[model samples]
Target: MPIQQSGKRLRVPWLRKLDENDLPVTLPVFMAYCMVAGSLRSWNRIGTKTIVTLVTGDDFYYPVFAEAARFFARQIWDGQSFHGNVLQWSDKNFRHEAEALRDERAILFAPLSYQIQDDDRLLSDAVVPLGPRTIRHAEAALRRARLPITGESVELLMTEPWSRLSRAFQDRRDPLQAIQRLRSLPKAIPPAEPEAASPPSTLGLTLSDTHGFGSGLIEWGHDLAKDIADYKAAIIPWRDVENGVLISGPPGVGKTMFASILANTCKIPIIYGSASRWQEAGALDEHLKAIRASFEEAIEKAPSILFIDEIDVFGSRGETDRNSAYMRAVITALLQLLDGFERREGVVVVGACNQPDLLDSAITRPGRLDRHIAVPLPDAEARRSILKHHSGVTLCSADYKVYEMATEGMTGADIERLVRDARRSARRQSERLNGDHIIRHLRPLIKLPKAYVHALAVHEAGHALVSHEVGYAHVADITISRWRVEGDYRALGCVEYDVAADRPRTRSFFENAIAVCVAGIAAEIEVFGSFSQGAAGDDAADLNRATELATAMERAFGMGHTLAVEKFSPDAFARMRASDPELRREIHNVLATELERARSIIRMQRDAHEALVTRLVDADQISGMEVDEIIRKHRRPTVSLAKPERRVAT
Candidate 1:
């Protein structure tokens, strides 16, 4: 008999069939039997305390079958009584609980296993035996469930995708060949859409079209493509080819999109998969099988790109022991597959992850995921390119430029979302897409709350004013808006100053920069009567810079009162402060002196500061030229105060 029925002579057909000698049990038959038994027990007004135990060998089907039993129980009993437990025979603690469950007449659900023992021997009276599903039983279940199998007739059931089969069938060691015999029996109905249709390719996109990537990245891609072309044309040897590239960056920086585009540019098919997909199988062996299948498919489709998204999921060792052995085995299999790529030509493995730091060193070692590409946030120019790419033609060049400036520090994906939002706004208004519509939609996304706008304007205005006074000639821009809202929306504003990339560094330079950093806090104290936490970020950073400069002046440059150059450890510095009160006094004096200097600078240019703050509050952003115009209009050059002389080494 397919199902081993004991104890009761249930009237269910499948169970009755099990009483006969000729019946062959299968997964679907077992599932149907459980469903019918649960429903009959409820219909016949069987006591709610009755127990049912299901036994099977396939671990993957344990949960599914147990859930099926409970679902039918609830539907028929109206939720009065239905409890199910899906236990694996391999669970280490199963033996401890099995006897107690048997004593309490608890319904046990398990897959058939040769190693069944202990309390399993006690449930012999109520045991229900389930076996591999036959094609007929599998089809009946699908028909009852109203699910569509592929267009293939009954004869092709064995040749259909494994996804259509039960876990029992999928768990087979040789599933493909095992299903072949079922193909000779009959014809099947065609599906409306072919399941085998290829997904849309992204080959048309080029590196130039994908903004926010650096020039070096674009060049590398071009070189890789060239090498592939050269190899195809016999211009380069196979061994000279680049193997694989690992792309790492913050999320939404276009790593996956770049992979697709790269594959398209290289004129190769891309096979994409992720660890999460393999993890859905719910068993260690099944996950490994899926991983092997994906690699095998990639190898079979040579001249292809294998793009693994979120590769960090297979993190370094010691992450989890729940599946440590399985994870290590999976990683081992992956290592082997990656090594195999060297012997095979035309296949490139691209692994993209947000946390490359968490990945195992072995996975990213030489010759395996070798090339590392970082996709950084878009700079102003790249933002311009991305904005223009996503904006409608209705938006003029000037509009694109303005939006680009506003979108500073945004990623290509963020820009795309902004453009999409703008388009949606335009569509809702039933008006032509234009700059005004885009800005209207974009403002709320990038602007701060109304209460903080004035303070932010004051804060950034102070930095701009101080930077100009300290000889930072090129103040790029200042704004009370952000390109993106970070955690908790605490950031109020920013000041962008252009410093020469190769400028010389000196004590005076560091001092001026420190003053500029603290100017915001100084402005808040001077204007708002008391400072808020708004200045905490700037104050802490500026104070750290000032402290570092003071430490360097005393220890490294021999610029302190004592000429002896000596580096002090943190503990030594703390001791020096405690023992020599004057040393602590000197550091405090330097920072206080810088802060007072910034305050004086702001005080001297009070009119320009007010005008700039007003403009910033009203306009939300102002360019360097606008700032210069404001300061130039309100110029009142006062007699400069004599600076304090530095303490020279005795």
Candidate 2:
């Protein structure tokens, strides 16, 4: 059969081909092959011998495969007495059995220790294939069994097999009710004596397993681990150790992973729930109920870490309109749950959000989700560590550095995905992963058009040149290369300026800084005969900073035309243009004066500026020394006055 595609769904032909070939299969093809074999016993027997095989790296799924094999053997024999042997591939007994059965027509069941090849003749021609399915199938099954469950409830039950067993053994076939009962069970079940010091308990994890996180995070994890160990040893009060933590960062910065690792390292079970899970309950009451249930579950599983991801959904009351009473109620309920944390022992709530500013202050304030930690974008060394961790294949230092440079501003998740993509590319070409493969994957993502590159080069060159000329001797580096584009601000390039050790901090210093900021636009106007939208962001940011400084000098320092030193709120300053005309005029003048100064400076240093831009365009990035050399070689020559030329009158 041919594979057919309609819209997003593809009608796969491999399964149909397997059936046509009369292949022997196991239960939950991917998860529980034994269960599937129990259901398949009613099928008519086939005369032809069949061989069944299971391939998975996970040992957890082995029992399911074994049960399925036994059930399948009984069904094929139609209740006739037949024995089956289970043996490892390397066992001498298996080798003897293989030799004796070499010419006999019989069914063989073998479970391999590694992934099977897609084109393996035995698998393609004889063994049935199975793939993993998420909760959608389980949801359908529950619905067929006349059980009431929201998609969120199904997700909760699908966490592991114990939940599934609870659902199966429920007195009343209500999944939600069963889940409630399960939550009320004693969370801290003492382990069997010998099993207490086992590998599974530790999960083979430590704070060292975390990559690309800052020292602060490492210390935080260590502190949590110590607290957990102390609590276990009855050395510290439980309440002192179970504070709610709010982790804020950009998406893909591993905020969620950090929370999970903390729980794992401390050998505590973690109850994973998100705002979306509750919201998916459909109705407002249902949403609130789901939220309550999640909290109750967390409380029941005391000594566990409850991770509430996307916590920004319960934003500040001021952020919502009066009409959004439902949202307001949800926020109130969440606040109550957070407050109730005091009554519950051993449950540490960790809330993760991309927009921490939007969260309710009451929740984030002390005594609630008090400990606020910011997970920032990874630096060069962190990027290198992230790359090394994700790149299971060998990569040299040079290759790592190249990857690091190529992935500036990218999050840890982005780096991992990039490596995965590069590996895929290498596999497609049947070659080992290399720098070329990575570069090939990254170039299209990071590279800009030549025209844009030139504009960006000119922009950064202007900033570098103006800053160097304004007595700021510390010029770090300039570049027209970047991996990511921020919102509305498509950064073509950037210039890093290192401040001089003894730089003055005065009104004149701020004015010069404003000139440096505007110089990029001035360069564009001077070189291109007009400026592009590229400088809009720089213009706004610099102008805002400059205006703030000027406004402070006038309003707070008594340096305005009136010398009245009257302090005003930020709101008042915002309305100053309409209410206080003179102050607005003064700000406009300050901005215009700095703009003209910047333009004039660019005009004077045109030759040096052009040289820098040219170098930036060619090299994409240049060091501070290279920039200084360019400026020194092309700086406007200062001509000394002809000393007493009038003496030539003799």
Candidate 3:
């Protein structure tokens, strides 16, 4: 049974010789197996009958070894005569499968999706990664078959060949299917150059007018613009000026807008590229080419800004997985390109991402994207400015403050969306856009239930009351939502605190902080006999903070039963929680103790808590001063802090 090409017999001279066994393994798959065998032989594992080989690559290649392992077993190794049994990761019971293969002289193939922690014993031998090297081998095999290699063919060969053949020739596996897939790649037409955006003079907002950006970032952009202008006038050297920065923030916080505004301020063109866009160009080789082209284009248009969005997709080299080798190559290429900009003046590289922590360290190293700026959620003033700019209106002072409060927790993009929707509604009714239009849009169509609102008010009031009494930190403000804002609406209210710069962070202070953290839940339970799900669901929720503080107290802070400090990195902290059961129990004990303390504080300040909740429900917000005045009027008793009893294992 020869493998069938389009409508004829497929012929790859080397693979044709293996047709006697009717094996379904394609040439690329065969070559990959050969590569693994070569590695095992090189390590001198010849007589070791039971071997474990872990293959890591994209999920697309899993079927090569997993589904067709029996075919591989039927075929003899080119030089080595010994054949062995094959055991795969079974969906039913992997532990059972491992046990079944233990005594037999078998070769177990674990796919990339294998859960390593569940069965660490399976990682007994070599890890065979099939990435770019595998593709290169496929290319070599194609060259041996005398196939023409063009850019389109190469792109298709790298990406589409495996995926397409896996679908089209599922039963009739053939190397000729790869060649056919490559040759059939549609040649992409070069896109025409887009007309440049309206110059800096015509852009909507100047750097000074833009809100929701870090002050340092704004100042840096202005300085760079001036430096570029000076350099054009031959008044300064490029070495004296900073050339790049990486802006990081949550999505819709105006990272992309910052780049545009910076380019407008600098009076230079901005070339935008993203990791997804580069990847869409094709596989590794083509992706690298696209990245290079972006840099070269920016250089050609000298004194321009090269903005790379979602740059974190390149990822850090420290993390290891199936994609590590591939991403390492990509990150290295980007670093070289960034270093090349040192010689080329006037190209300021600005990278943006939602997660800057995941970026390769070298990407933001000194003299590269040296200044890493975090763009935070819009502050009250910034939200006000964003509303004014987007709504294209000037409001009275009272109205300005109202809308400012109403637009709380909204990003610049969210504000713009609100304005756009409001304008649409006003136009549909044939009326001029007004504050009422914006306000109507800002408020949720279906109001939050009254019960939920009261509970939220009580929750926030509890936190504020506790913090004010503890005197550990200053209660900044308490706010409750009146508008349908973006993001997790789980948080109906929030209590912010400003810790004193010189405050002592003793064990008592930490314990007090933990009490304040659990106060919201305590407040609800005290007032309503139960609590809502608000305190526990999200990552940044109340219970998570309390748990983290409790974990830190026991594991890192040396404030718990143990005197020795066991330091762990952020990643290691998560692993410690999973591995150490006793540590978890100790953390539970800390939380339970603090939760009781929070309940006591809430009980003592019941009158003050009730008054504050009423005020918050009425105002939908209260200032720090207003909160203090309410607590004063309620005549709260002084809060007494006592040491908590820890449980001892008998």
Clashing pairs in 2: 27-32, 27-33, 28-32, 34-68, 303-346
Over 529-575, each residue of candidate 3 has an lDDT whose tens digit, in order, gives 98878687444788877877777777788887788877644445556
Two-way TM-score contest, 2 vs 3, winner: 3
Q: What value does the lDDT take at residue 650 in candidate 3?
A: 83
The global C-alpha lDDT for each of the candidates, from Candidate 1 onward, is: 0.63, 0.62, 0.68
lDDT of predicted model 2: 0.62
Stronger candidate by lDDT (2 vs 3): 3
Q: Which one is best on lDDT?
A: 3
The clash number for model 2 is 5
Candidate 1 stretches with Cα past 4 Å from truth are 1-200, 212-214, 318-345, 377-392, 397-454, 461-492, 497-519, 535-650
Shift in Å, residue 334, candidate 1? 4.1
Candidate 2 residue lDDT tens string, 337-415: 8885436577788999876876878897776888888888899888777776776554577766556656766787777
CA lDDT, candidate 3, residue 569: 44
Global CA lDDT computed for model 1: 0.63
> What's the lDDT for residue 635 in model 3?
54
- What TM-score do all the candidates reach, one by one? 0.50, 0.53, 0.62
